[model samples]
Target chain A: MKRFWCLFFMIWPVLALYVCWIAPSMGWWFPFTGPTGMKAASPLGERIDDLFYMILYITTATFVGTQIALGYVLFKGAAATDEGNTEKAWYSHGSHNLEVIWTIVPACVLLFIALYQMDVWAQYRVKDSFPSETKQGAIAEVTARQFEWRIRYPGLGPDGKPLPLMPEPQPTDLYTVNDLHAVVGKAVMIILETQDVQHSFFLPELRVKQDAVPGLDIPVWFKASKSGDYTLLCAELCGWGHYKMKARMVAETEDKYLEFLQNLTKSQNYDGVPETPAEGAPVASAAE
Target chain B: MRSKLVALVLCSGMLFVCGCGRTEPQFSYREGLSPRVQEYVRTTVDEKFGTPHKIRVWDKLPIQAHTALATVGEGSKDNSLVVDISGASRPIEPGTEVVWVGGTIMPRGSAPVTVEAFTKDKNLLSLVAAPPAAPKAGDKIVIGPGQTLTHGRLLYAEHCQHCHGVAGDGQGPTAPYLNVRPRDYRKGLFKFTSTKEGMKAHRSDLARVIEDGIPGTYMPSFKLLKPEESHAIIEYVLFLAMRGESEFQMNNLLASDYSDASVANRIKDGETQEKVIEEFVTRVKEGEIDEEVNQRNEKMIADWVSAQAEDAVIVPKEKRNASDEESIKRGRELYLSGNLNCVACHGESGLGDGVQTYSVTKNTDTGKDNVEPGLYDTWGNKLKPRNLRLGMYRGGRRPIDIYARIEAGIKGTPMPAFGAKLTEQQKWDIVNYVLELPHELRTPGTGVAPASPATKPAPVATTAH
Candidate 1:
């Protein structure tokens, strides 16, 4: 009975590992967000995904090893307990060698990983370290307010003003609410701000999330390889109306991007004379 | 003994495996909430549409466990019989039996009994063979204070609950933050319904709102959602609207019937007043007075249900008046005219800051009005009349959309229908005036004179206004 009990206990650690890690990896249900996270949409996202898998592999191995060791300890101790040999180890001396080996091994492995990940981290976070090919001046400034995103683009004549509806944006600044338009294959930059509280400008597929803190102007950039309409969700719990704080990111060919801006401009200004700009749209900056 | 122990271990091991093998039971529409809500199970007097209802739970609670039981009365839109947890908090799994105040649940076709749970508790719940014929004011109406969590409720809680209140009152957690508040369905009214007349916001109208959201508001188009899922949401929204309407009616009826003045009128003097008051109270409790209330309720429910009748709309008799400057000039003259009264609600500058600024008055029944109103809509919340200076239209900004808004007044709001009062040309004139209000207001100095044909700027196709 004792042997059986010990054996059952021995397998529990293994069972847990199998259920939490192995089963999920085998498609039983890991990636609890559903299936696999949609394939990353940008080069930066792909790099992030690669880094994620590398850490996952190392951690998974360590987890399986630890659980197996736990099972082995229980399995070997079963015989002595069953035979009524319940004796305590009196020797207080710890195995310094074993401790050193375990500690040093993990430290070395982690050090190597940290050193290897620096480049990817810098490429993503450090503006100065960004690829020269993707560099572009601020395309638009997005302001986050209660339950909506107010986006402003540079308009013609150095002043953000409406141009006639045409296939081409008259190099004039434009503005829109709850929608962002950008040309695909070209790196785009946006200056983000928050009118009221904390908001995370999150693009899940692009693997981009930036906090828009009140009293701060944070710049974020991304390039879309594919042209399509994607979602911009407020990842932060800004307020009760956060769920409705959804915006559409329309990434397409240059022509389509211009077309979208033209239509929005018409809607924003309507008449040649300026009326109240699209609700939350900001007044054009003179310097820009 | 060893063999016995092995057998016991084996038996337990097998039992454990068997327990792990069975998955949570899948619910068929018959066995669960989705199909039940999809069908006309609980309906208003019209029976053409089902009564609206939804489950209420705190956002923190896991949506799966809670369920609701509604005591659906035949032919009457009774949204009473609310079921909720009493105590012992824990995550409930499938098939948990909930006992109600009116009696333990009985299977379909079981004979109805006068259970103490029903008569004793004001909930007045009866699942089988309809309910007791008469319901008095004293009878507790329980239109789902709680329900067995249904699939529809789950969907609504996830998608719509944050903005639309748990009961569809449009007072959700985020409702306060929005400049333009969402529609409160308690009045069972929607602003832009599909048809007008018999059924308010017909089935298609609800579907349209759900699919293509209202413009210039926080509402978004949910066209990406699957057909079945959107329909489920539609049904759930209706459930909430109907439930809210039922509660609204009940409150109104009780307040009027049991007012202090009415009670005083019942007893003219102290002498013989005790006996007379007792009789009056008895009359109220005996369901005698309910007959009249119920008749009124019938008309109210029918009016709500028939809001979608085809004839309930206003259409232009002739083609839209040309949007030329001359036409715009004609439109502007009528806009500032005293008869139209556009300047009263919409100010001189058309900034929506007119004479009705923050009109505060006491609610007669409650004698307390916390709400300060620029203008109160059907939901009793402050509504900002659209700033005509900004050509942002809530219903839509299209020519016909704007025209229709003028011809027929926006339902359940301060906007009145001009179709009856004004001719088509007159209504068209109003639409043109509204559309051009922003332009005229923007260039204040460039008014009336710009009406000359030769002096007028050429039409710009890009000019959305």
Candidate 2:
């Protein structure tokens, strides 16, 4: 019983370490790779996945090595105790060459990762590094309040393209409360601002998240290569209403997006002149 | 050997303990549902609505509000009340021949009605509601319960119906146990909407509410739900609201046309109930009833449709009058003003216990004053007027939140809207005064103190635009 118990105790860390290694692939933690699939939807998203896997692989190796070493020490110590020889076993100090190799290898690995992740970080974070298409000015203003997202779209002309940037407010500006609409192939910029408190604008699929500071218009741009809707949720705890900030991103053909804009514009400026020759009033179509 | 054995046991236990994760709020998805309700839901709703799901963008059909003119009853010529609103800065001008604003303008017990109509002399008018159409018996009811419901319906049943109820009546079994009862959507009224005073909530408003669940109540946020699911739930809630409201209208019509008293009288007089029903139908068709019920229905639908239009959210026309001492002083004066009725409920010192707190509970409507006095909400829970000094506002603490509360009054409670009675500046003034109450109480300040210790005036972040 004692021998069996000793063996079991020795293996516990190994099991834990094994579970940690398997957890991500089994969809236990993110970059979730298991049945509950979460995949990269953008270039940055892929880069982030790469950075994550790099850290994960390195961490797993370290974890296994450390745990096995710990288990080996326990096993050897227990064997000594079993023999009733309660003396520190004669141990040799680490070799100078081994120490040099160990230190240099880890340091080199760290250096490589640090240097490799720089561009991905710069492309993702630096405001100026954002795609040039984003500099044409924000296509929408997303004002996040305590519990909801109030989105305003640039007014489009009869040609289905956004009107030119101007210093003044246009009456044709289209507004929708929760849903953010963008053309699939076009780069959309959001001038995110918080009306009351701090909120993070996170689009998990697009790997886009930027804190919307109160009184600051932080520009965040994303271009959806695939045309589909994605979840856009608040990643910050603004208040009790934080969890329910489930807004969505609609990435569709420019025509469908224009139709959505037309509907929104029609709803907001119902009394104003027609922007497009589309149907009577855009039917209260919210679902497409 | 013994040490090894003990170590093995202890090691496994430590391993188990270490595996335990950080604590989180224990949220049950099917919260507070009895087995019976759950089973009934599965059989009735699922079989009928075709299994609930997430709402697609296309599922967001616009809600049309009622906005049709109601015909004045040609018979009630002498029942007009003259409203002297000339003193009120924004006096409502008589529309082009008595247009209906939301629905019918009907006279209720003289106090319950808004101005019915402007006399030709512009002095006397009926209160705003249309004349009560007599209730008639009906067999056809409960439309589309089993039809292909929108994806929102499934999500609503899965998440909301356990507390809100199948009929949106706020009578789910768990309702009785809740302190802040789930909202009853049948009246088509919501408390924390982003809508302006008296305006219907926007679809996005409903969606946000579902996502952000009411913080201090049983309404837990459905944040775990996919965005599509939340949108679907919003649609379903709106659908239920519309359905319940229509049913309420139907009930009103039936009660007016065929009340118990009228039925008893008809039986005593040897007149068949069938005969009365025929007459009622004839009256409806010929537009000979007090007002056309069909027209009122159309108007009701229009009111809902119009609610989807712009101006759903309340925006003050100008920059807010700064919260200076003068404003607070003026607010104090107005709060105690007899017409404002703030003191009657909020108390002289803003402690939330006003003189009317006790009176509001007495059954004046039912004339059962002999019963024990205790204020109860429509949910049948004891109603507590907001403790203004505590400053723990449940709706929110933002100035706009307070503004909305003052202007629209908290729905589902006894609070009455002052938007119709007071100006926007007045509402903001009240907000300032209410916020000041806690501070005044704490330090013996010159002005009104605020409601809670934590209720600091957080700087409002606004768009530079």
Candidate 3:
């Protein structure tokens, strides 16, 4: 029984290592392949995954080494108690070099991870890194309110004027009070706000999540890679109806998106006249 | 043994430390349901008519049937109370008169009502009635129909004042719960309907909404009021909202006139306040202020209200039948086509997935995208639109559900109220089309095969000059 117990203890770490190393890479039990069913976004997600594997391998090795040392100590201590070979058990001071090696190695590993992770974080969060000039551009505003997310898109009218955007500091520009949609392939900046409480905007496939803060603006950017229906869900608990605040988002080709927008604009009846800028007049800058 | 004892003690200490985390509040269905139902009844009734004097059960036993008993006046000894029956968990068989007696009657300006309910077999169900009324400092002003101002003010204070504020500033306490906050009553821009086309919401559109609360929001239905009461409330709410909006516009105008340094200096010298007040009074008396400005603001607000009314028009009682196969076919074609784009947001398969599923963008109004989730039904429940293939609609399997949604557009979301855009016939056709989407798009030999027809593209809209 004792021998069996020892063998079970010896095999557990190896099994755990094997499962951890092979499971995700093999995609045996993974769900939700990120966006395009791909492994990572940017080179950074892949790099981080690589670093994760490296740590896993190193830790597995260290665990094996420790197990071996423990086994050896247990065996040696038990065997040294024979009466004929009885002697004062040798007491050795802990090795300063060993302690130094373990401490320095872990410190170096942590430093490497910290430095590498900063770049990944910056790549995802930095607004400047956005590929705003791409053909399939990002032009959508996400408004998170109590238990619901309201999306707005600037639908162009018949004369080809884009509808006014909202949360525009000028009270007059609070146009399209609620209808939110935008044309495809246009660089759209979404100004986020909350109506009653805090909520979050999470797009899993786009790998973007931003909090919907009331009395403040939290901006997020993402370009749809394909024309498909994606889901928008609240990631925060606003109230009892939090779970029901689900909506659909459609990313279409430029022509199709524009066509959709035109249909919406034509159908909607606005009370105010369209605010047209004078020809050759200087355009007002957005609020800083 | 000593080491083992230490290890046990340490493990127990760790467990205690871990257990110190805050306990999460558990979801309670019963607690949430009762209050929601009660609030829904109260708000709906009050909005429909003025506050009721005594809302009680009608009978002595079998307390299933409840009624709203409102008194006509403060001190009339006659049978001034009008009792209207409302609410039933199960369908009430025709001619079944379920009543409960011994229910306490609370006066409009008095203390609480304590009532009890018993089964036909004498078992008790519940005893609680109305909550106690708070103390009032002044004698209640009795306003009759002829006194429109007094009547409007009394009604507004009772119903609209809680949310619209005493000054009509839309800063109501309950305003916080609404998704699309309560109409500031001061903006006068009703987002739901339009009246410019000589179209008005049929009486039922307003009454039904007051009866059958908006499905997914804080707006609860006031089903307890008689038809007359509901009409009165609607008028009262509208009057308050418009009056507030006009006042707000006037204030803005006055503020603009005092902006100049000389005007400011005069105000600083304590003369400007009286001058501004006099000017305001003169303008009110003359009523000849900027006609264009007033027209523009009025039109803006009128147009919004018109849109809401248009959206709220459910199919007339006559057009709800599923008789027109051709219209339904056309509706199906439209649903599949680019126009109405229902398939895009709902889904091609009618599973609510077209091109835009799970796509995240910011909301134009609130500025936060990543919206919570999509369309739900009444009952504050989450219900995805039926997969067209499945042919099931929780809102009722009738063609009217599809029609009303297409026409009115679901309130409080991205669903643009489509009433103003779609013709009444087209709306019905769309409903027929939605009902047929699942079956029409289904595979052949799947029990019920769709009638074969050529796929038609959406008609291109000619720009209105």
- Whole-model Cα lDDT of every candidate shown, in order: 0.58, 0.59, 0.46
What's the candidate order when arranged by decreasing TM-score? 1, 2, 3
TM-score of chain A, all candidates: 0.76, 0.82, 0.65
Task: Give the number of the best model, judged by DockQ.
Answer: 1
Q: List model 3 lDDT by residue over A1-288, tens digit each.
A: 454555666677778767877876777532244344544332433554566667767777788788888777655666676458778789888899999999999899779867867765665556556445422322444556544554445434335544444332211111222233433334444656676688877655445466776666555555555555544556787775565455544556767766665554432312112234643321111110
Give lDDT: candidate 2, residue B115.
44
Measured over all alpha carbons after superposition, the RMSD of each candidate to the real structure, in angstroms, is 16.0, 20.2, 22.9
User: Which portions of model 2 miss their true places by more than 4 Å?
Assistant: A1-6, A9-37, A84-87, A91-104, A164-169, A270-288, B1-465
- Candidate 3 true-interface contact recovery: 0.00
| Number of the top TM-score candidate | 1
Q: Which CAPRI quality tier does the interface of model 3 achieve?
A: incorrect
Cα displacement (Å) at residue B245, model 3: 39
Clash total of candidate 2: 63
Q: What interface RMSD does every candidate have?
A: 14.5, 16.1, 20.3
